[model samples]
Each structure stands twice: as structure tokens, then as C-alpha cells.
Target: MADYLSVSALTQYLKRKFDVDPYLGKVFLTGEISNFRLRPNAHQYFSLKDDNAKINAIMFKSSFQKLKFQPETGMKVLVTGRVSLYERTGEYQIYVDRMEPDGVGQLFEAYEQLKRKLADEGLFSRPKRPLPRFPKRIAVVTSPSGAVIRDIITTVRRRFPIAQIVLFPALVQGQEAAQDITRQIKRANQIGSFDTLIIGRGGGSIEDLWPFNEESVARAIAESQLPVISSVGHETDTTIADLVADVRAATPTAAAELAVPVLSDVLAEILKEQNRLYLATSNLVKNRQNQLNRIRQSYVFQQPQRLYEAYLQRLDTASRHLNQVMTTGVTDLEQRLQLVRQRLLAESPTRLTHDDQARVSRDTDFLNRAIQQSLQTKRQRMERAVQSLDQLSPLKIMGRGFTYTTADDEVMTSIKQLHPGTKIDLHFADGLATATVETVKPHEEE
Candidate 1:
């Protein structure tokens, strides 16, 4: 220790060594995360650790923005960055430029993370609104210079040239791209009378297509008042925005195709319906004509008098049958009248008048005797029951011998309720008397 090195001096030397050394400047590292803290300002401070050692690591807001999944403690990560020294704290750390989930593509990892989050929050489970079958105006959010917009325009023009297309220019990748895309989506909604929104971009690597996976962009799509169709990359590439959007398309062209129906196809269908109507009318007219021809060729139309001839023959046959039926009916009526007269003579009242009269007289006498006997019996029984009831009646019993005494509206059966000076009523057979209760003498049964 010939000369003690200052902290700044040592850090500066270390920084210089990190800057020049090929291995230190750029490195691809794999390790487990520890002591990870996500900053409020969108930066990450953490330590990367292995079995024997650990090193400080930092992910700035810009680099962290590219990550698909949030880094947490005990997570394995693969990071590509440079090793550098923090002169202030005299600590050497790795400044991560790019990061990916271990053993998984960053885009897929991000998709899973966003899917889980949105599913938990019910954004993905929310009822999706149906897109308008015939849109008045379709607003497209994509790169202004990319083939995605061109493909959409060409497809829409070929299918439905009548519908209007409005383009909202946005960056599909790079820094702040997600925010720009979200801003354009909102701005397009405010500035236009667009019935539908198509957000899309051309296919690319996950790193080149990270913006569409941002949570802000996904939330923007979810909250949009206009129905949003997300067409990101090819059919294979799905972004978080796709999950929350009202509809998802395989490609930009597919999105435009979904937005409007083909005018030529509709015209063809109309033409087909018109042809069917014409054929049906022609067939109906032909059928009616054939029926008229058949009627004209028949004997009735050819001769004209043949219609009356048939009626004349039918009238003759009906008249003959009617005369025969009338003759038979008169013969049957004469026989029925003769039988009825015979029955009437056999049942005549004059034939048995004496016997009927004697029987009626005998029955009348018997009925009168029976009624008189029954009435006498009921009267005697009723009288005896009345006498018994009279004997049981309180008034009748009291009339014979007993009397009733009461005090304070209660029968004087006991002395418990009576006081010495209480006034009482004594009831005999026909009258009651007032008496003072001088002493309550409790009666004992003999």
C-alpha cells in the first residue's frame, strides 16, 4: 500500500476496465433473480445470483419496457446487456438491454402473463360486442408506411368499395410505440364517426413486435367505445391487445374482409332472388294456362250444352228416386198409425175404471190411517221429552224447593271471595233479596 486509492479512482479504473474488456462490455447471462424491486417509475433494481456468487443488475425504463413478463425473485431469466460500474456506490452491476423468460420466447411469455392478468380481472371474460355487419366508416390503426395498411385498403376496396376507410397513423414498434398506438386509437375515436376500429401490424419477431403486447394498449382496446378488431402479425402471433379486443382477425386483410360484406356477392344474391321470382311467376302462369287448356278441351266447354245435359239426367234420376221414397214412406206411416191406434185401445182407461177406482180408495184410507198413527206417536214422544226437559230446567227445580244466592255477580258457592261487609243477593223461586254479608261462614258438606 504505497499509495491509498480513493473510492472514485478505484471506481473509475473499474469502469474503464468494464468499458474496454470485450467480455465485460457485452454479455449473455443466465441466472436466478433475487432482491428484485420494481420501481414506481418503471425501472427495476435487482441482483442476479448463481450458486457461488451474485452481481447487481439494473433494468432502465426503456429496456424494461421491452420485457414481456415482470421479473420477480427466484425467477430464472436470460439477459443480454453490458457489465458496468455505479461510481456513486462503487458497485459493479449488469445493465440489462434485453431480457426474456427462461426457456420461453418473450412474446409468448408476455402473452401468458397478460392473459392471466386480464382473465383474473375479467377483461377477457367480458361479453364481446358484435361488430357491425355493414360499417359506415372503419378506422384503421397501423403503420402508415407498412404493407399492412396497403393490404387492408386493397382488400376493402375489392370487397366493399362503398364503405369509407380512415387511417390513423401509429408506430407499430420501438420506444413509446405502444403509447402512440393507444393515443391514435383514442384520437381516431374522438375525431371521426367510425363505427369500427381495426388495429394491426405486419408480422415480425417478438422483439420487433413488443409494442402491441403492452398492458396500456390492451386496456385501451378493452375500454374503447367502438368495437375493436385486433389483427396483429399472422394467425400464429397473438398479442395481449388481441385478447381484450372485441374481435380478432388472422391478418389485416382478414380484418377488412370482416368489416364489410362483398358488394358483388350481394348483387349476385339479389340477382339470383330476382331470377327465382321470375321463374316462379312464369311457372305459375304456365300452370294456369295448362289448367285453362284442359278445361277448354273437356266436353263441357266444347259442346256448352253438355253441362246442362248432365244436370238434366241427374234431375230425372233424382225425381224417380224421390217418388219411390215418398211411396214407401206413406206405406210405413199408415202401418205405424194402425199400430198406434191398437195400442191406444188396449190401454184405454174405461176398460179398468172400476178396479182402479176401488184400489185408489183403499190406498187413500190406508195412507190416512198410517199418517194419523205416526203423527200421534211423534206427538206423545215429543210431549214426554218436553216434560223431562222441564224437570231438568233450573227454573223448574228452583220453583219446587231450592234457592240461588249470589254476591258480586258470582254464585255464592264458597266464602273465599266474600268480605264481611259485602252485600249479597238471595234468589228464591220467584224473587231475589238483598242481604249484608256480616260473616263469611264456610259451609261443610253433610
Candidate 2:
């Protein structure tokens, strides 16, 4: 019993020793993970082991959040961390800082991880953009030595010789391939010459085709402003890059077909349109000719003089009818005038001038005698009537000792209408006497 130490003191000493040790400070270890469990809080706790040796490991929540894919038991992983002692548990373990998939280099896992993520984000939705129908310049991202580029070139040339093909000359496989493809895509965008991008490679195994499945490449395709067509691996082969791409073709030649339009087909379409135009023009001309022919065959158009001839004949007929009516009217008027003259002669007293004048003179002498006798008789009767009227005249009566007494130019016949002092005039045959009314008399007659 040289020196007995408490477990706490012992563990503390060991923890300090491990923490300060140079060999255990930082390490890179390759092992298969065991007893791995993801905590509900996202921390990872596992054991890294070989056939004979094992050590406890922990991935904190923050460091675990950085991993693109989930880890499982028995997964081969390369971990970099420092060996440290847990003071509380008095256990030795490795605190993992960084991790990568061992056999697959973590790229595949990252590819799958990104594919699931983008798929969840709807990047692989069917609403992908359509490729250009007539691309003028097509950019290709593939090895310049491969049959993929050759096939694309030949297909594009055969389909549309007018389309210019530019090669981006990128690596198609291995570690550097993904970065190369991404760089070239960016470079092509920077150059800004190509109208469309065709990213493709010859068909290969999954390992040989791993680069195209990279998340970086997928993201590059997704972020590209220009349209991209992805043709990688075999027809059945699918990749994360293909999912994020604008269009996915089965083959390199298919991608070329998608990029450009067929010149032959276009020419055929134009020729068809031209033929239609020619037919339309021909029909128009035919219709016009038919119209002209119909016009020429018309009666008025064929014999223009017939119109004037018919009008002149109508005018002549009208003139003859008018002349007949005038002649008949003149004859009837002449007969009427003669009959009227004869009737006037038969009924006229002035037709026998001597007899009429003698009769007129006798009648005039008789009228003058009758008029004189009438005048003489009228004068005698008038004298007698005047004598009788004179006998009845008021002046005559007044001459026979009659006078009229008037007050205010009224006869004072009534005593009731007279006043005793009223001024009056007395009318006599010789003169009128002005006097005051002194008296009035009333008489009662039976």
C-alpha cells in the first residue's frame, strides 16, 4: 500500500493526462461503428471498433447536425477526434469532431441525402422547364475523348447541322469529376455564349458514375440560370444531379435532340405552308376569272347598245301615245267650239241686228212714256198726300191758335212734372216766348 487514491482523484488524474497527451490530442481512425443510437435530442453515441479493440465515442448534437446523412450500426466510418476521459463517468472515450463514410467516401451518402432533401423540397417535380426548341449554340460537359461527346456531336450534326456545338471538356468520373463539372458549368455561364447546356457521360457502373450523383453537381444544375439537360449512366440509371436538372434524357443523343430542332422537319413545314399559300392564291385567281366570265356573258354587258336601243323604242312608243292623245283632244275641242258657236247664234237676239234695234227702240219709247206717266201720277199723289199731311202737321195746328208750353224742353202736360217757378218756353207758330212756368193744368178724360 504505497499510496491508495480515491476513484474520483484517479479519474481526474487520468482525464488530465489524456487531455494533455500529444499522441491522444488529435487522431484519424478508421473503424466500424457499433451500438449506435441517435438520441431524441439528436446526439450520437456509439463505439468505434476493430476486430480486437473498441473505444466509446460521442458526436454532439451540433456536430451531428452537420452530417448530411444518418448513421447506423455497422457502418464503416472515418472519424477525426481527440481521445478524452469523462470525468463524471471515469471512462475513456473519443470525442468525435468530423466524420465521413468509409467505403463510399461519404459522397454517395451525401448524394442520397441531397436527393431526398431536394425531392422533399419539390425540386424533382414534373413542372421542370422545357428545353429550347431551336438552340443556336449547345454546350456539352463531358470528357473530350469519350464516345459520349462524339455521339452527341454526330447526332446534333445529323439532326441539325446549323447548330454549333461547343465542348466544355470536363472529367466524367472519380473524385475530381464533380468539382470539374460544377466548375465548367459555372464557367460556361460566365462565358455566356452557349444557349443551352448538355451535361452527360457514357453509361457506367454506380462507382464510375458517382460524380454525377454528387450533391455539389446536383446543386450546380439546380442553380444554373441556363437550361440544363442531364444524360448520365444507363437508361435506367438515375442520379441526384438528374433530379435537380431541368431535363433528364435517357442518352447523350437524346439530350442533343432535346437541345435543337430538326432542320428537315422545319423545312418540310415551311414547304407545306408555301403549298397552302399557292393553293389559296390559285383559288383566288380562279374565282376572279369566273366572276369576269360571268360578267362578260351577261346580256347588258355582251351587247351594250341594246340598252340604248330599248330605251329609244320605249321613248318612241311614249311619243306616239302622247301625239294621239293631243290630236284627239284638239278634234274634240274644235267640235265643241263649233257647237257652241251655233248654239250662241241660235239663242242670240243680236244676231238679227235690224229687228232687234227696232224692237229695242219701240220698247224704249214705250218705257219713256210709261216712265213719264208714272212720274206725273206720283207727283199728283205726292201733292195730295202733302196737302193731307199739311192738314195733320203740328205747325198747322199751332197756327190755328195752339201753343206748346215746355219746361226744360219737355212739354208741361203733367202737373206732377212741373214746378211753379221753373223756367219754360212757349212755342207758337210765329215765335217762342221765354217765361217762367206759373201754372200747370191736369184734365181727366172719360
Candidate 3:
């Protein structure tokens, strides 16, 4: 065989061929993506596949950053790049410069992706806040020197001059404008004075109005505490900020109109309501006056005191009836008393006779003597019981030169209860004595 080339040499030779070939330098391809993963702030590495073949692909961070849509697995996409050999790995792959969805533009794909993401996160599902019927203080967030600001100011001034308009000028376009809009929104909340917020800009192309579609601006509008009115572009244009805002108006002037009530219309409504209230009050007063007059024509009102006359008459009649009933009750009670007196006089009091009184005296004397005898006998019996108790008491035995012995606080009555080295107590009439026995002597019965 001829001299064999090393792997590195072969790879370098192939790389030179690819670089010189104009067709390999710029190749456009369409395929399904596979093994696609986004590295944090780094380049992307993935594979592009079709039904019949597959190829390795890479995109540097610079090119990836310029992509409008994120590349995902299984996505059909078109890539514009060059095929080159990686000499160290000896692998030929495509280095992509730009990418887009296969059939649609990257912008449209990005729009769909962001819309789906926000929808899944419930950003668009939140309840829209109602606008104030009459805003007192309104804040406008837009460019200071634009037709949007001018239109808003003019519309609001013509509609409701009483409302105070505060302006928070912000950049409404370009790459850095999303962060600016977000900062202004937070600043508006920090100030905490405006009743409503209007964030808007004049109409422009999709690329020009892209700041309002940015995720940062959308998040800012969603998180705003104030009721946000979005008027980002023309009637035909819609942005993510509009989807997330509390209210969306077609134009800047419409946003302003929605923020505050029309002064003339409000004044006319006030006048109408005032007239309605006056007529209601007048009718009420007239009705009450007529009611009073009708009441005055009534019989009770005409007679003045007739309402109470019947009650007074009934009270007088009741008083007379009460007096007659009391007189009859008194006469009946007097007759009953006289009849009882006669009956009492006609009969003798057998319970109070002389013989009964004498018998009671004799019984009382007998009871007194019996009570005295019983008390004396009970006294003698109690004294005998007390003497018996005193004689039988253990303390009385102790007084007779007898000693009581105990061990461990238990009374010991037998010699067998003695234990050597045990503590013992000897109780006497005077006090007690504690003793320890060195030897036990159990007594034997003779």
C-alpha cells in the first residue's frame, strides 16, 4: 500500500477542501432537529435529521443570540451555514449562521412560542381589571417627544380636565427599550400616585414595535399594580403587552379617553340626577303634607281628645263597679263576723275548762319530775362510762409503772417480736425512749 495518512493529516486535508469549496462555504439545508440543547450563554450543539440521513450541527452564541426563535427538538427548520471539518475530532459538521422555522419565518415562530408560553403560565387567563369611571390622577408611559404623548395629552385635556396627568417618559423601541419600559413601570408603582397607567407608542413595523412584545415588557405589564391601558400600535397590531394589560385600546387617544370621563357628559349627567332628586324630594314632601291634611280630617283628629275619651269613660265605669263590689264584700264580711261571734258565745270552750287546766298542770308537773330523774340517771351513766374508758386507756397503764415497747413504729407485745440491732421505742407516762437491742432474748413459756 502507499504511505498511509494519519487521522489528523486526513482531517486537515478535508478541512482545506471544505474551506476552498464555495458550495460547502455557504449551504442552505432543511431538516428536523434532534438532540438540541441550549447551553447557558454558550454555543448550541445538536443534530439535524431526515428520514434517510442525519448530520451534526453547531451554532455559536453570537449566531444563536441573533435567532428570533428558540430551536427545539423535532422542529423542522432551515439552517444557513457552512460545512467544515473539526480537525481534533476528525468530524465534518455544519456551523450555522442563521436559522428559521422551515415553512414560516423565525418571527412568527417566536410569536407563537411566546404566546403559548404565556398562555400556559396563565398570563392571559387573569381577570382584567376595570377602569375607573372617573380617574383623578392618570400616568402616561411613552416617549416624551412623540405623537402618542401629544395625542394622549390632548384627548385627556379635552375629555376630563380635572384629572391630573403625570408623564413617565420611556424609550418605546430598540433592544434596550424593554428594560427601560420595565423600569418605568416599577417606578410608577413606587410613586403610587396615579389612579391609572397608560403605556403606549405610535404605530410601527413589527421590528420597530418589538420592545412591547418582549417578555420583560409583558411581565412588567402583568405585574403592574395600577390598572394598565396598553395602546402600543395601530388597530391592526397587537403585542404581548396588550394581551397582559388590564385594558387594551386601539390608539393612544382612545386609551386616554378610556382612562377619564368626559367633563361635559359628566356635568350633564350630574344636572339630570340633580333634577331627578329635586323632583323626588318635592313629590315626597307634597305626599307627606297631603297625608297630614287627610289625618287632620279624621274624626279622632277633629275631636282632639276623643281618642282617649272612650278609655276614660271605661275607667270611670270600672271604678264605680269596683266600689260597688268592695261595699258588698265588706257587708258580707261583717255579717260573717257577727255570725261567728254568736256561735262562739253559744258554745263552751271545752279545751279551756277548769278541770282541763288542772289536768294540764298536773301533767306538766309530772313531765318536769320525769325529766329531772332521766337527766340525773343519764349523768351518772356518762360519768361511769368515762371512768371505765380512763381506766382501760393505754396511757393509764403507762402511768402505773408499765412501759409500752415498739419496733419500727409497730407495737411489739411478745418476746418473739425482738430482733437484734433493731431500733425500739419505750413509751411511758412522761415521754418516750429510743433504744437499740444488741442481743435478742426470746422468752420461753414455763
Each model's number of backbone clashes?
0, 0, 0
Best by TM-score: 3
Per-residue lDDT tens digits of candidate 1, residues 1-446? 75999878888998899889998878999977765546766778877776677888998998888777877655678999999888999888999999876754334555678779888999988999799977889999999999989998999899989889899999998988999999998998787698999999987645457798888898888878899999997775667888889999999989998888999998998999999999999999999999999998998878999779889999999999999999999999999999999999888888679779999999999999999999999999999999999989999888987888798788987678788999999888899889988887777879
Evaluate model 1: give its TM-score: 0.46
Task: Tell me the lDDT of candidate 3.
Answer: 0.88
Query: Per-residue CA lDDT of candidate 2, range 300-323, in tens?
Result: 887899869989999999999999
Clashing pairs in 2: none
Ranking the candidates on TM-score from highest down gives: 3, 1, 2
The candidate, 2 or 3, that scores higher on lDDT is 3
| Among all candidates shown, the one with the greatest lDDT | 3
Stretches of candidate 2 off by over 4 Å are: 1-111, 288-446
Model 1 lDDT at residue 35: 57
lDDT of 2 at 134: 81
lDDT of each: 0.86, 0.85, 0.88
- For candidate 2, the 10 contiguous residues with the lowest summed lDDT are 103-112
User: Which prediction has more favorable TM-score, 1 or 3?
Assistant: 3
- Candidate 1: clashing pairs of residues: none
